[model samples]
Target: MYRLMLHGGVHVLEGTFVNGAFHKPLFFFCQTTMSTETDETRQSLLLEQESRHTANQHTHTEGAKMPNRKGPSGASRLKKCIGLFFEILYWLLTLILVQFWKACTAVALSLMLTYWLWGGWATFCLMIAALIGIFYNLQDSVLYFPNEPESSRLYVPPATALGIPFEYVTITTPDKVHLSAVLFKQRAELAPGVPTIVFLHGNAGNIGHRYMNLHELYAMCGCNILAVDYRGYGKSEGVPSEEGLYVDAEAAVNYLHSRSDIDQSAIILFGRSLGGAVAVHIAAHRHNRDKLAGLILENTFTSIPDMGSVLFNLDFVRWMPLCLIKNKYFSIRKVSRIQVPTLFLSGSSDELVPPKMMQALFRICGAPSKQMARFEEGTHNETWRCRGYFSVIRQFTATVCRPGSNVMEPSPSPTPGPSLADYLGRVNMQHQDV
Candidate 1:
């Protein structure tokens, strides 16, 4: 009948008085032995845990001291080397293409002119021949300015960035050249038989440069627009030439004809500057003439030879034979054959192309319906920024391209503005004063 009890953290053994002192002595011995075993087991566990912690610390310290022995793979090194080689090659080619040829031509022309000044009549004749050859070869460089402003060829900002939904398209010319283009459709559901404009830009810059104009046209006119970059411009392939540009325009129109979203019968061709020449060609040609609903020409020239006479003030350059000119746009000759509704947007203060040329084109245009909008303070490049530029275009398209619309009445004559000669005279006077 011995009983064990805990008192103040000590184990006490108690027995009834009947068992006497013998039970107490045996229970006490048993309690002491059990406490000793428990203490030993606790100490052993603490020692084992401490030893494990120390081993783990040592392992981590050793790992920290080790270094990574592996280097970049052979494939990585090869790729870097190839990239460097191509970069060097690209710069070298650029220098040769842009600077070397130009430098050589300049030196050659200087030497030839020096000889012509001091030598006999035979030398003069040879110099003339050389000049003709040089002009012929370099005409493309002077006419096509896709690289002007430097940034034009480098990057073209996307239409989507301006919140205008557009489709980036590639048009293949009949000659197998690829051209870059953008198709912008109105966000709202268009009514049946809505018109589409084939936007042809000037010689310099790509389709992206015309984003602001395109945006305004799309929003204000409420029409579908397909803006295309001609050959050798933007992302389009092949060199730019007068014939090549005409081909590019034809290809763009043909592309529209193939599309289901576009209304082929309501297609309009809108061109500015050199593009105006291209548009006139398309509108006059037998193939595309009947398919077009309207024509829009802005700040465009008459012909390459006419522009040369205006741009080059020297008597010798102005008097040069027109046959020497290689890229003759000859828009004046072509405008007489256009048989569709036409709109002429003229900048009175235009310094590049004479306003008279635009007026002449409008007068002679064979289109049954036509209108001329004159912006008095507008310049060659800034005419599109004029206050009533887009409104005039919107009005023309609305009146001309609407279904069953037969309005062929000509617009009233626009008031004449300052001529290019007057503008240039003022410029010269200002420069002389300065």
Candidate 2:
């Protein structure tokens, strides 16, 4: 038996040669002779014996000779001691790295759950790296928002014909964040006390990207809408922060409330993505029952941490630098305190913020007129543009999203998928129906 060190690690082997047969964990390029019964049998037996005796015995013998030359030298003893210390240290570090690998594995397993619900190429890349035992930097690889703002491909109506028109309105927060806004209302054709809503854009381009929502709420659903850009977005000035966004939302909502053309009794606040948390903040603290109507939250979650949990493999992060997330954007903590009708929208394929996290927000809401609708294939920003989202929002506006009334349709379960096979089957069924 022998213990060997190679390939930066250690291996143990035990072997024997008997009746010209070999057994060993080591391999060598030597030949051995065996008594011949037949040519094939003799060759096989000789190879087995050679394999059994295989090892770098030359190297071992050389080491043994060096010790013999030392002849009880303290230098030899010292060298042996140093070698032994390093061997133990190497193994200890390896063991620690192994434990780290497992911790990384646990974190990967948690992310697999989210990936299973909303499979994406990025998640697949991360998972593949994990399975290969690579020490991937989850924060550097995953928790980053891209540096440059993405350009939107849609048009911003020079004056969005939302109804009550002021020409390309410019509004400012008390803290001096300038928000460019457009308001729409029809007093007689649109009921004076009819539900009024505000549009909060996602963390992408300006209000132009939200035109589908604007057109639906304003022209089709017959609700007054005030859509504004947060700071650092669209024509809005100043950089955006969690608190700064709230101030922007407040400025826009207050702008509507102050308007004589738009009725305050029917005022509703709607937020998308980051805006959803902003809306919750307003509904929880700033909203007056006498002034505001209801709430609509689309593709939003409980908080930034709740979002981080969904977006990344979080177990390792539960103790890591994730603790430094100061801008909580925590809506779930505040939603239960809100006192109005609330409608929640979630997207089945929302990779940025999975649909399941919405359950936390729904669970905490205090309003009786709370409704949640999920678009089967919608991601974070486009839930309302999905097939059923427009109709759902329109219906919500007509019924539960009404002024001074906290009424809502039953929210669907927040579970995400049926399968790709299922989506294909439905498409074929729809063709048959046609």
Candidate 3:
């Protein structure tokens, strides 16, 4: 019998059981013609597949080898360079315009001086007009002294340098200005009821300059201190203005209210010099006036107009209209609106703000309770360094803010002192004797 089998796509014929008996060895014959045809077809198919694969690989390799022309081109680079050049040109033109304006101002002033010296009435009138205009435009710069000390603008030391535990905070005003502040907490664990002081510094320097004073206040009063740099001072953003400072103070107070660690009810506003005016503004207008524990004003002027009269001593300047005074911190007018307990820290020898100003404020204050402390040898800036300075503050805070109470206790009325009229009379007599 003969049988056919297929192997590897080729046909083979096999013979067995020859002559009615199975043969021990089987005989096989391959179909050579069919096998040859299948091998040729397979070889052709393999060659075609290899060619397709090689072609795809070559195409991919060529694509990868090609440079990416979609990247930044020469024209884009040139455009960027041109944009940079124009920006530099714009700044240069701006600087030149500023310098030219200054030069023109100088020449105009010189001509006005010459005409005035020669008794030219018409030119004198013109000079006065020019001066008024200049003053109106530059009043903000004149009133704010954030960079008076050169180092104030260049450097602000961290609160940690004084070995006090502090957190650097940024507060945002409603007007979108960012204020830099340092919150100094006690080294030991602080009670939730501990009073927090919002320290508003004077006009001249950043909060860093007040760190030593803050350290002393923190230790003596045993209160958390929040020292803030007003707008345009230190790392704060924006130019300083009278309204801006008021909003900044409000924002700080709101920030204290937001914190869980702070006692919002026992918050105190401490202001020195220009800061006193700010403190008065906030205390007068605070929506949560009942929550405020106290207000502390040190060596603070009564008003900008009063300061003008004292500082210039010129009849025209002294009588200048309030409308013409652009930056008017009229604290005297606002103090009567404050409902919180108040402390007036005065320096008798203060060369800047007269101690009489503090006295006048104390007399006018509408707080439930008020007290005045005078340091005889203290000057405007050194009052805090005087003995019993912190003691007075400690006593005042203790009286007003009771521990573990969210609502401040009503402080007892302060002991009566000399009347404002009597104080002024004594001051006048002293001056006359001098």
* Candidate of highest lDDT: 3
What TM-score does candidate 2 get on C-alpha atoms? 0.55
lDDT of each residue in 236-338, candidate 1, tens digit only: 8888999999999989988988887656778889999999999999999877776888999999988887787788765465456777778889888888888
The estimated TM-scores of all candidates read: 0.66, 0.55, 0.66
TM-score-based ranking, best first? 3, 1, 2
Q: Stretches of candidate 3 above 4 Å error? A: 1-130, 286-288, 402-434
For residues 1-434, could you state the per-residue lDDT of candidate 2 as single tens digits?
44332322223234554446653355432233333245885477456555655543454456577744436778879999999999999999999867665546656665577689899998988877675443333322232232225443223446534333334678989997777776655345444556678888777667766655565545445566677877777766776677888888888877877767656766778888878888898888844544556788878877766666556667443343434554667687788788777778777788787677776787778875677676677787665556555555556666644445332222221233222222221110010000
- Tens-digit per-residue lDDT, 1-434, candidate 3: 34454644455443345347644333344445454667676577447555655665576579789987898989989999999999999999999768545534444565576786786877777777766766776766667888978868768987766675788999999989999999987544453667889999999889988877776676666778899999999989998889999999989989998898877778899999999999999999858596578889999988988888788776576478887888889998999898888888888899988888988888888887888888887899998776677667776788788567432232221223222222221111110000
- Whole-model lDDT per candidate: 0.75, 0.63, 0.77
Shift of residue 31 alpha carbon in model 2, Å: 99
